[model samples]
Target: MWVLVLFDLPTETRKDRQVATRFRKSLLDDGFSMFQFSIYMRFCASRENADVHARRVKKSLPKHGKVCIMQITDKQFGMIELFHGQKEIEPEKPSQQLELF
Candidate 1:
């Protein structure tokens, strides 16, 4: 499972910039990695784990911005095609999580 957080926050004023920065920091602190300027993604071992992160993202949303939370299966994510200046690039592979009994 993958939890993708996409947001566009206001950064016109100092306070707005601070709030936006805090939001990004919170996402990083919660284990999400930057996928793009306004996109962050985290891999989870299960749907339940993804839900937890999605809830956390909701809890930290800024008061004056647009935010979206999306969940995709590993297969779906793997099908994504990336490019850099017309050259094809491979999509990122999710890190394997160690499980302990």
Candidate 2:
């Protein structure tokens, strides 16, 4: 499973910028990778695990902006296509090594 987090936090003032930076740091501390400036992604072992992370993200949301979360299966995540300009870039692939529970 994958937990995708997308957020847009205000940065109109110094305090707002600080708040946004703190929020981004918190996401990294919680094991999310920066898929984009406001988009973060993390891999979870199962649906329940994804829910746990989603709730964690929910609790960390900022007061003045929007936050969204999505949960996708490995197969669904694999089907995502990325593009830079007019070229279609290769999407991220799942790791091949088996994981021991």
Top model number, TM-score: 1
What's the lDDT for residue 43 in model 2?
87
Q: What is the overall TM-score of model 2 with all chains considered together?
A: 0.88
- Candidate 2, run of 10 with poorest lDDT: 91-100
lDDT of 2 at 40: 94
Candidate 2: C-alpha RMSD after superposition: 2.1
Q: What is candidate 2's local distance difference test score?
A: 0.87
Looking at model 1, report the run of 10 residues with the lowest lDDT sum.
Answer: 92-101
Instruction: Please name the candidate that would achieve the greatest lDDT relative to the true structure.
Output: 1
Tens digit of lDDT per residue, candidate 1, span 1-101?
98999898999999999999999999999999999999999999999999999999999999999999999998899889899989999887778788686
RMSD of each: 1.0, 2.1
C-alpha positional error of residue 30 in candidate 2 after TM-score superposition, expressed in Å: 0.9
